[model samples]
Target: MARFCLPRDLYHGKGALAELKNLKGKKAMICVGGGSMKRFGFLQKAEEYLKEAGFEVQLYEGIEPDPSVETVMKGAAAMEAFQPDWIIAMGGGSPIDAAKAMWIKYE
Candidate 1:
């Protein structure tokens, strides 16, 4: 048998990042890949939004395309050390995939 799980809540559209303010947490770790998000200013906006939400935000940037085992382990170690209540995967799919692995290792 197989089971699938999904996030309890999903927010989107223009201003979706602002919804972070409604989340109940003190710390949040943002995982991002490459430079697009940074170049485009989404990364900064995310940090600001999280801060406005009262979270101490930490960033795990530079997750590469097709992420490596080493990267995943390093991200997991960072997560272990930071012990954030929320892990926000930003940017593209690579960061999100890396964050998922890191979350599993963190648990």
Candidate 2:
């Protein structure tokens, strides 16, 4: 049988990213693409919130526009090493999609 898995909670809107502070986890791995999020300050804000929530945040930046298999492998390896309880993907669709694939690979 086919099965599905989804986040238990989903928050949106301008300050939605702030909700990261509420996540209960010891570690969080933030996946991002390029420097748009960083340039806009969203990336720093996300990290700060996660850190405020007592999570050890590790960043896996530069996920590229259309991530490659090698990139996925590297991200998976990083996830393995970091052993994060949560994976926070920021930026555009590329990073999110890459993170999703990395999530599957890590598991």
Candidate 3:
């Protein structure tokens, strides 16, 4: 059989973070930035969802805009320790973009 492992099984939009509820991972590392997700409480929702899914979820926040290479390395180090099967990025462009870089390093 071919070997292929996609990131996460599902991505729910609008309220996609809720999708974490169904994940089967033992751990999840969430990368976020600024305060939008927190202000709206999406970060809490995402964490709750992951926990509901039976995962030991943690967050790596304060990612800056146009994230730097240093930031990516630090995030990657965090993932190495968490050893999460899932990576949830919530917030603005900085978080998403930084999450992408972290993803590459994680793999």
Candidate 4:
């Protein structure tokens, strides 16, 4: 049998960052690739938001486009080191999807 897991809270739409205020966590690991987040300036905003929510944010960036299996391993290793309670992956679909797989590997 296959198993599935869902987030306890899934908040979308506008200004979802406000929801972070309710998150209970001491550390957060943000996974990403390239400059899209930084180019749009969402990266800094997200980092600050997590910090404001009392989470120590550590970024695992440069995951790269298409993100090879090796990249996933490296990201997972970084995540292991960060030991974050919350995994925040922001970027295009590829990185998010890859990070999700990496997240599973971390667990």
Each prediction's whole-model lDDT (CA): 0.88, 0.90, 0.82, 0.82
**Better TM-score candidate (3, 4):** 4
True-vs-predicted CA distance for residue 62, candidate 2, Å: 0.3
Candidate 2 per-residue lDDT, tens place, 18-43, comes to 89988998999999999999999998
Candidate 1 lDDT tens digits, 9-86: 545679888888787889999999998989999889888888988999999999999999999999999999999999
TM-scores, each model vs. reference: 0.89, 0.91, 0.84, 0.86
Whole-model alpha-carbon lDDT for candidate 4 = 0.82
Clashing pairs in 2: none
lDDT by residue (tens digit), candidate 3, 1-103: 8554445543546767766787787988989888788898888888888888888988999898899999999999999888989788877668877887887
Which parts of model 2 are misplaced by more than 4 Å?
A: 1-10
Q: What lDDT is reached at residue 16 by model 3?
A: 79
Model 4 TM? 0.86
Candidate 3: C-alpha lDDT: 0.82
The TM-score of predicted model 3 comes to 0.84
Residue 53, candidate 3: alpha-carbon lDDT: 80
Worst 10 residues of 4 by lDDT: 4-13
